[model samples]
Target: MIWALGIFAGAMVVPAVAAHASVEDSEVLAAYVQARAADASGALGQSARLHGAALALDPNNKILAARTLRQAIAAGDRPLAVQAARILDKAGELAPDGRMLVMAEALRRKQWKEAGLQIDGIEEDEVFSFLTPLLRGWLAFGARKGDPLAFLNQASTNALADAYAAEHRPLLLLARGKKEGVAELAKAASDDRAHSQRLRIAGAAILADEGDRKAALTLLEGDLPPIAIAREQLVAGKKLKGAIDTAQAGVAQLLVRLAVDLNAQNAGQLALSFARVATFLAPENSETWLVTSELLAAQDQHEAGLAAIANITADDPFASTAADTKLKLLIAAGRQEEALSQAEAAVAQPDADADDWARLGDLHVRMERPEDGAEAYGEAIARADSAVPGSTPKWALWLMRGSALIEADHWPEAKTALQTAYKLGPQEAQVLNYLGYSQLERRENMEEAERLIREASRLQPNDAAITDSLGWAYYLRGNLIDAIKTLEKAVQGQPADVTINEHLGDAYYSAGRRIDARYAWNAALVYADEEAAVRLRAKIEKGLKPELVSP
Candidate 1:
């Protein structure tokens, strides 16, 4: 649930103050300037002087008063805080937070009634509606003055968007031993669809408290939309086919609404709790399980989530989604063997779709099982090639296949895959650059490789590696003059790239500028890895002697 009012707590600006006769007051301005400098250095001593100076310059400025109060609160100077609060009070206006700080201190001494009085004293009751009522209810709850149930419930209802009020609702009732009342409230809430599904679903469990299985069944009998109805079943375990059916139209829409409301109202955590309950109730609801799985993933509890997905059935529409979730969980948990096995099982499924095949392929690639990955990619290509543009698998599969082939050390095959992907989406300069660089590294296709690399650099001129690759290709072709110039350009574009700097150093040496070459190599040595640094260091030590290069 999003707390709309909570947003009001931060950075509400005070209108800027107009300069007054005291603006140029030397002592005050000097204090103010000193304090500004102090603030930059994270000091509080200057805050006091600055407050005094600002107030002196403009006695009527609420901005000064508010800043003084806030700074005093941060400085741990109660006397200054009291002084600032007094100023706001004397002006017949108040900041919503002004008195809360003082009241908090008063409560430390068991001055409960005093704190309550302080809350009532805030001048702007209308602006502080939710806060004032909630605070009063808290004080009442602490003092055990009657049951705070009535007060807190009223406050929660009035402050619908207030998280504290909502969370406090069950607490107040629970302390009063109102299990029956809470259960009764759930029963009564059966008519409010906004909160109806929650009530009905919780009915069976909470009704167990009332020993009324009949009422639980009655509440569950409503022609509730698919999502709510499906979720009712989701509680059976974790995964469910019905979860997808429920999330289809009306019920799915409601879930999103409820989810967003819970998120916006700061009830996101509460929503998660409720979602868990909902999933528990309808354990067969795959959609609900999916939601829970995603939530668990976001919370970094992917392992337990895989267990939840284990409840899904083969006939479920969302079964593959559950499989994917399990695969991801296994991967995240470092259970690569399990993920690979699961991928193979999914690949063998008779109804496997293009997406399923793609996922299988990607899983293989992730595990460094390139041959298997390529076979899975092949299946996806055969399947998706006949689909419409939007239904066709994106170029990513081709890229993945290409990458797998590269890792398999099949340079020609990798080139073929990459070239196909490039032509499909030729504008991706990274792809173009990688293919070009790969060819250059192969050392057997210099001219065509140079053409591709130069084209990539032209498209993405600021890209450091593409520029470096073009320059490196030139050097490999024995065009030392052009290589030196282009590598120098590459160095200018990527001053921090150790490899580019190293290449520049080599270019300088090849151009017969030994001293300049040594300087560039010295710079490269400072940032290069141990191996590169060792090579450069040896080069420097040898002076006129040569150093061996390694692949």
Candidate 2:
């Protein structure tokens, strides 16, 4: 049976008859073309239905059949995905993605030989060339057939292949009881920084198995985000559990790696299917749960995303990151009060670290409790020491504290914190912009403020907020002409920004453009916060005072 997603508000509505009616081939093809265009624009559900409808009309169109298979997989319509796969298999026209769908289904059904055949039959073209060896190796390893590590090592010559091998090959060794592989695994991990997290997890597990529990604990007690399995367990002589314990779990881990890679490349919809397969195979794997939640959240399935994150056990080392993900998902879902409460509670926990404190501070600031935010940031800064085993004290923690203090109207403290951040990270554009903008707001150190802001704009020319800050700085210095020109450009880039619009209006009024000033103020009024809106309306009605309109 074909699946149809309900129409989105602005999405083009397909004819009701198109799906059920015995439509002409040309008409069906027309619908397919329109749907393909929409799909390219990210309307996956509508596109999948139209593709299904087109396949119904002309069942023998191989290209349409392949597209329907791919779209069905992307839409999470497993039944439709399977149905389309059958169609494509009959026509012998499966794309690489379609083949992956077939392979996932085969693995799900435990048809190991069939899955192996699917991997073997995948075309050795440019697109699949680099991926083929890893895919084949994983299948071989899962079936306990050949030396998969040899295949992985062969594929490691490629950068991406090396990263994948560095991530997963150690897991294979652990699974197969290959203690001898640890030395090689450690060297590979040290060579590739990109896969450090995976290597660390594998290395810790290997060390635990070697009876070096203390070393394993030391290996993991760093700033990097932890994987599942608690430090307490490692310290108590329990081995860290590998995600790939069984063949099915091994396949699932491979699928998860593929999904993560796809996600990094922004192929999120495609990544979703792989993640779904991974979760089904290894629900106990906390990383898979995190990836599944992230993919669902990316698709705006907030409730499902929350549930997925909630499935992670609290004792998992990755639980903190999962908690962080949950907070953001709640905020995105407009459950801000819940997010705030959760963040507050999380930071108050005994094990809470600098990142946790910083998260709480950010939440407080976002919820408009700037004073509370500054306190939380202060806690974060106090936690940043060698005892915690982080790489370095993050300048960002001080920067956030400083910005929150500025928001709370504590000028001297804000300046101190910001100066500390500047000394730590002089090249950071965000630090430069915020500190400079705050200086401009304070109406002090104009020369230094201008220099910092100029450098920030140079570093990030397209950042509308930075550009607006530069314009506001000009306006503050009584350079109405330059202010008008710069603010106009900033407004062009960020028209809906209440502050930018307000700045533009002030510039216009100072330059004797009363009509344009009123217009800009009205635009600002439309998007401004309540306080800003009140000020904007007053200017719109009573006009700017002489001081504001002065040269």
Best model number under lDDT:
2
Runs of candidate 2 with Cα error greater than 4 angstroms are 1-95, 108-110, 124-126, 156-163, 179-195, 206-221, 225-233, 245-254, 344-357, 379-397, 419-551
lDDT of 1 by residue, 401-490 (tens): 787888888878889888887887677777777777788767767788788888888898878788888888888788888888888888
- Whole-model lDDT values for every prediction: 0.59, 0.73
Score residue 335 of candidate 1 by CA lDDT: 88
Stretches of model 1 off by over 4 angstroms after superposition: 1-332, 387-396, 478-505, 508-551
List TM-score per model, in order.
0.39, 0.63
Clashing residue pairs in candidate 2 are none
For 1-551, candidate 2 gives per-residue lDDT tens digits of 01132233113434432443355745774767666665655566667787787777866666566667767765556667777887777777666666776776787677889987777766443555566667667777777789988888877679876766765676677657666555555565553232345556656765677676655555465444463244555765565764354556666666787888899899997787777666666666777778878997888767667877887876566666677788888987889999988777877788778878888988888778999999999998888762243312578889989999988989899999999999988988888998999888768998789889889999888889999888888888888888888889999998888888889998888789999999998888887788777677778888897534321
Number of the predicted model whose TM-score against the real structure is largest:
2
User: How badly does each model clash, as a count of residue pairs?
Assistant: 27, 0
